[model samples]
Target: SQQGEEDPQALSIQEGENATMNCSYKTSINNLQWYRQNSGRGLVHLILIRSNEREKHSGRLRVTLDTSKKSSSLLITASRAADTASYFCATDAGAGNQFYFGTGTSLTVIP
Candidate 1:
């Protein structure tokens, strides 16, 4: 079974709105990362939060990690129509330097 799974299968929002997504994992992890994928395109790394870090922000993206709870969240503020994309969470458990990914959350930002 995969280590991580994201909540909310899909989401729709208007431009200028905010979008939030969550991810849960089964075991201890060394780090967590979020990526954005536009339809029919490769993914782009958005943010990465290490186990020692509680939160991090890059531009409009905010990521929070709770190692104790084995959970993490990604928040995007002031989303734009171009922000419409599928988001995925990846977890690294320090096992062979491999990372497992969540199913993903599809976000649609309407103009």
Candidate 2:
């Protein structure tokens, strides 16, 4: 499968702390995207890094990609209780508009 799997199905951290999640896929991909979903809400796009790129950052979020290992990581620094959400890694397998999402890592940032 071209789908990726993320480690640590769930994580809990205090506010102002850092959270990290890792994902590993089975095939080459065009791009990988991270999304955040709050309870009962649609997903919000956090970041998207292409295969040729190694790392990218936005605000308190940092993402790293290693194509050779078909793996990726996302780091969220100084997280807040508002950051509590389910995070998913999605990969575009060079196909149409389809993407395969990881099982997801549920993060809880306690205040």
Candidate 3:
């Protein structure tokens, strides 16, 4: 895996359902973050998980990190139409404070 490699190129789901995505990284990271973008626009930070942490959640979003495997996953529960967006995982190596983003997963939520 590269610095950021998200699985599932695209996804389609109905409102009220759940959407899950995965990401794998190459080198060790200081922290991992998840972001969302709508309509090919700017990205919104969703959650951030430090290498020392295992899992974190905010509202309907849950993020998990497995440093041993160098992987992470994001789960959106009770997904809404507004949840339809591109999801990306980013890694921060703590080197110059730069973040590298993944390929991204396009999610479509039908209402």
Best by lDDT: 2
lDDT of 3 at 110: 99
How well does model 3 score by local distance difference test?
Answer: 0.92
RMSD of 1: 1.0
Query: TM-scores of all models?
Result: 0.95, 0.96, 0.95
Error of 3 at 16 (Å): 0.9
- The digit string of per-residue lDDT tens for model 3 on 1-111 reads 346989888999999999999999988999999999998599999999999999999999999999999999999999999899999999988573788899999999999
Kindly give the number of clashing pairs for every candidate: 0, 0, 0
Q: lDDT tens string, model 2, 27-76?
A: 89999999989989999999999999999999999999999999999999
Overall lDDT per candidate, in order of appearance:
0.91, 0.94, 0.92
**lDDT tens readout by residue for model 1, 6-73:** 88889999999999999999888888999999999999999999999999999999999998989999
Deviation from native of the Cα of residue 46 in model 1, angstroms: 0.6
Candidate 3 stretches greater than 4 Å from native: 94-96
